[model samples]
Target: MGIIWSVIFSGMSFYWAMGGRLGVRSLGGALYEMSLNPSPSFLAIVWLTGFIKLLGAALLIMLLVHRHNSKLDRKLFYTVKIAGAFLFLYGALNFITISLHAFNIVNYNLDHYATFWRLAFWEPYWMAGGIIYFLSAKRT
Candidate 1:
């Protein structure tokens, strides 16, 4: 169970790293394209979010690589578990946003089936993995 939790956390960390990289790239491009008139607040938010994702990924990797025989490893596992819980909660919120957007339930423009597909199928597995990692890490 510990190994399984470690693997799941590691995998999620990798996924989040890649997602953060892509988001930074794409959002940067979009901000640039907006008449080169990027909002300072928007850019700041993007940078902050990207950094958090990168940091989370690094912490997860550190936790995964550290040997469990040490006290430090246990501490790292606790940190990873907290981070995993945050990630899963954030993912759940994202799914809720998607559902709201897709159903025209939010103030923004509806995305029709695009958001629906994401909320209905894709995000659950990631959320589940995070939950499993959190539970297993607690036991460890």
Candidate 2:
């Protein structure tokens, strides 16, 4: 499930980086605007993000396939845990940040669509990925 999430999200980034416009508005605000006419740097950034997500998926794959070596397994466990922590914190922090904006506790430049997706879907999705990675790593 975590691998699926990472792949799907990464695909979107790849699509956008390749100038595919579908679902770009869901990004919202400056990001959506930039997607319409992305500069080279923005394209690079998008590609980097896609690669990062793929790295998450790849890490899980490594854990699953490379279990014969005990030393490698130990390192993989800690690495996956670190990745899980990153995903969990990324989601949780964004969720909290958006929630704060909703209540006017903080001021962010998010639009209605961005805020809606962040609160209702994206943030939770990332958190789910984190939990899934943690469980998968433990089981492996």
- Which prediction has the highest TM-score against the true structure? 2
lDDT of 1 by residue, 1-140 (tens): 43454454454434434433322222222432441444666555544655554565565566556465778877777887876686578768867876676666774432444355456554564576567657656434
Model 1 alpha-carbon miss at residue 72, Å: 2.4
Per-residue error for 12 in candidate 2, Å, reads: 1.0
TM-score of 1: 0.50
- In angstroms, the error of model 2 at 127 is 0.8
Per-residue accuracy of model 2 over 1-140 as CA lDDT, tens digit each: 77888899899899989999987775566898888888999999999999999998998888778557888888889899888888888999989989998788998777888888778888898888888887778744
TM-scores for all candidates: the values are 0.50, 0.91
Best by lDDT: 2
Tell me the lDDT of candidate 2: 0.85
